[model samples]
Target: MALAQFAREYRTVRRAEGWGSLDGAYYRHLPFQDLTGRFTDIWRIRARSYHTFLHRVLAPLESLTGRPLNVVDLGAGSGWLGYRLARRGHWVAAVDLLDDVLDGLGAVRHYATPVRPLLAEFDHLPMPTGHLDLAVFNASFHYSTDYAKTLCETLRVLRKQGTLVILDSPMYRGPTSGMRMVQERQARFLAKYGFASDALPSEHFLTPARLDVLSTELGIAWRLHRPGLDWRSSLIRAIGGIRARREPAQFPVIVGTCPS
Candidate 1:
């Protein structure tokens, strides 16, 4: 079945079986690191540094939409991306499964208006049609139980020519026993619930091939950047430089727009 159709079907079935409740509890119950704020700080620092070296690669989008951008950050834990986009005068909304993450980001101040957080499932976005200029998935796509469905809904709600930027770690197989065990565990959960398609860690991470599939399905053009070692080191060196770009970066950001 097509991804959108499958997602609608799965969501219906899951909702009927009370499976949606499990995701809410699972994300909410995770043991956050003691230095919770630090993680967000690190993410911001790295992201800014990457922009320094690769801004050339990413800057075109800014010009494409000359006016203030309306952005939505999905899985916006701590609102790092939302805060940054808002700082650049973008009207931003930060969405997440857990309310605590939204509460914690309340302290974040940006140039644009303070963000509004919406609590909703990935498969079921809480927005109207043609509402957003951009939607971002930052390092959290893999955690999505129904990524295909989520992707379709994201496209449905986006305005014609609106962009969807997914930043995620690529999927990989592991050699270590512990890693294999984790993979097995992930597989079991997915099979039991029909929640995911692949067992690789980055199953939700769109590879070039997968990107092609999504592009065709959603009718969006896609571009990818794989950061290099020097780019990665430079980003780490400067933390949050005013303007920078890097290769060999921590994660890849997939940027594409819906067809007009």
Candidate 2:
């Protein structure tokens, strides 16, 4: 058997026995029938964490843009951040793979329109060229099976001098050592299409080091800002006026700018 096939079988058997932390829910339901409810349930579980990330990350961009900005929440799961940003008076677009999932987010004030499904593959997203001012990947970058293609597609839709931000996503490693399971599953999913896993480097997923090099190669200026696990993000709704933490720690936001 091929390595990807082997990995898939191993993951299936492992998960059937409840061995890994990787949730098998998507393995069954995803890229299939409507999955709105499942997406909503998962996002609700992480609402607080999302709130913190949105506040810290969007706060500064809001200032830099000097007005309510044109923002796209790429891979926007359940539309939480888009909803929050729209409420704050920004023109937000919540794009996702499944139309039903985007529909599930419900009414969002100040948004340009109802949630729109991109429907295109992540690596080949179908947004118009040079339109969005800010694009965000909030803990959802891992789903793109082709990281480089996805990044290129993301950059394609960004306006000159625009910003692309990724937050709260680990390069690898997940709850219960799920990286191995993730690797196994993706390999299996891609094998039938005649695409071998070895065609690209496994390191395409964004890492701090990789992001640095990608920015330079792509001629984009970038910064690594971690709000120290406690720094209050200005992107949030400004709770109790809490002050940013003083200690240095790994925070979430990795902001980069497209050259004008």
Candidate 3:
């Protein structure tokens, strides 16, 4: 009940931000989807990052086997990545709280592949124990109000030595910087939308210390890989650092292995 309520509010904020575009076909194409309007550059960046995720993470893992993988996509907005996996013959469960046709799990119908859509919370995944080979929080982990609880729940469903991925979440060098980013974001949303857009008690960012704690508690070893940003983004971040005199948040593809 709480999950559904939080997701509906999140959807409202996303709609206000223009991400809930009515074009369902656009989202079905996913990382291969074309860009439009004010969010063009942002979508382009996301596409590039997703390709990096594919190259540095998925491709290599896929190469390791010829058989289909048992995979789960947590917070699978629009079911794009899940569709991609399902098309490749992997057994996939696409989980999310939103089932809206335009921008949520219901958009999975736009894809031809048979992706199993499950409307559920990430922390309390409706999956069998020790059955999944891969569990990916695609651009979604930072939305968790409790990272430890979420990961623990994920760990319970993962097979021994199964991999879990944290993709596209903003990771700062420290908690202070992360908090600043969160505050700034909240302020912008509050001013622009008459509310902070924090409909849930999400952590909203990540730090090394936080990751370290997860590693310790989950008994998992994490490998961090920072895929390169575009030259313009690189320059902009550099300029912003010079002016703001602070470290920019990074999107590192963080992969953690479940204990054997």
Candidate 4:
């Protein structure tokens, strides 16, 4: 099993670096149907902490709304989070770039409240204006090339006072640190893959200053929350024993509410 997993990772690396025909498609199509069980196992490990964090964030929103939420899960990947939310009786729309990935979720078979899997991009969500009670970008917001445009679109689709949550994505203290991290990631990718950095999807970390500007421009009140380290994360940190220099806050949950 270990050998097979190593082989799979090697192949994925090759694909990501453009050395193989897959050309980063393997990573892009993650959390897909995994009859072999390997993908699911990996996802379980990575997502466990995220799931707990998400539930904590959702609890207050659920209580405040006092009814099933009209929730849109932007960049929802395999839609597991949407499946869970749907099972809890919220009306969930799981939007992603890949239709096949969404279809594999089997939301209808698994949940009573069917999860609507929509193929769409973050900047141009195909939903009615002022309809969504909540919009969540779980580790997906950074993929946007234009963060401001995406935030504006998110606000447009949200109802008055609707909540927008950005979870499990990196946040920097300032623009300088954020740009430095971006360049470092690009450099690492180039070194490993021997391809143009753009071969992999573009991603940019958000900074508090940038968010503040966006919030003021859009007239939305926002707050940033750094998650407390859970057992899983703690164990990972202990094993790794810290890396190079990093911003004060890494993974953050940015919550914004559209003004009435």
Per-candidate TM-scores read 0.60, 0.57, 0.92, 0.73
Decide which is better by lDDT, 3 or 4: 3
Clashes of 2: 5
lDDT of 4 by residue, 21-96 (tens): 1223333333343343444543444354355545666778888889999999887755666776777889999887
Candidate 2 structure, TM-score to reference: 0.57
lDDT of 2 at 141: 69
For residues 10-30, what per-residue lDDT tens digits would candidate 2 score against the true structure?
Answer: 334433433211223322232
In candidate 3, stretches whose alpha carbon ends up further than 4 angstroms from where it belongs are 1-5, 20-24, 239-245
Compared to the true structure, candidate 1 yields what TM-score?
0.60
Q: What is the C-alpha local distance difference test score of candidate 4?
A: 0.66
- lDDT, model 1, position 50: 42
- Residue-level lDDT for 3 in candidate 1: 40
Better of 1 and 3 by TM-score: 3
lDDT by residue for model 3 (1-260), tens = 55566776677778776674566567665675554464665666677777777788777778886678899999898888888888878999999888888678888877788889998988788888998989999889999999999999999999888889988899988887778778878897778767786768899999888889888987989988877777887777678666655678788889998899
Let me know the TM-score candidate 4 reaches against the reference structure. 0.73
Q: Which candidate achieves the best lDDT against the true structure?
A: 3
